[model samples]
Target: MSFALSTTVDLDFDRTVAALREALSTQGFGILTEVDLSGTLKTKLDVDVPRQLLLGACNPAYAYRALQAEERVGLLLPCSLTVRAGADGRTLVDAMDPALMVELTGTSALTEVAAEVRSALRAALDALETR
Candidate 1:
């Protein structure tokens, strides 16, 4: 199974990133953290790489539901969304599939929450495609 849901955008990297954030917000997700992979690689290993960012996204209600279902689920809280420049010059956005939570936790209770999160993530990707 695909671990992520992804889409490619023809917009410039920065603009694509901004649009993704806005799209996620429209689906009730907030970016809790951002990691610049290029900067980190350059600083830590002196390696050059394409522009890449990892966004930690969270929907508060869904997070709370997951937490109540499994206390340790916080370890997987904040679904990961990545924005990176493709070799073809387009930007690629990838969101972690929330279904992984169900696979990892083996909790039937988390199924509904994961489905809701997946729907929101898929909507964000769908919006990006139309734009």
Candidate 2:
């Protein structure tokens, strides 16, 4: 199974990131953390890129349920959404497939939560694609 779903968007990188954030929220997800890979790389390694953003998204209810099912699930707490610029000047938005992580963890309790997260992420990805 694919670990992530991705699509190249015609929008600019920054707009893509913003649209993804809005979509995720509309699907009941919140951005718990955001990392600017471009900025971090520039600062840490003096490397520069056009744009690269990482968003850690989470639905609180699902998170709570997952935690109840597996205490170590925190290792994969928030699903990640990435926005990066392509060589063609378009932006790409990618989201981690919760089902993949759930399978990796090997927990039956996470089955429902994984389904919900996958659906929510799919909705968010669809919205991003439209924008």
Tell me, by TM-score, which candidate is best. 1
lDDT of 1: 0.93
Model 1 alpha-carbon miss at residue 94, Å: 0.6
**Candidate 2 segments exceeding 4 Å error:** none
Candidate 2, residues 88-117, lDDT tens digits: the string is: 989888888888767889998889988988
> Cα lDDT for residue 20, model 1?
93
* Cα lDDT listed for each candidate: 0.93, 0.87
TM-scores of all models? 0.97, 0.94
Candidate 1 stretches with Cα past 4 Å from truth are none
Candidate number of the best lDDT: 1
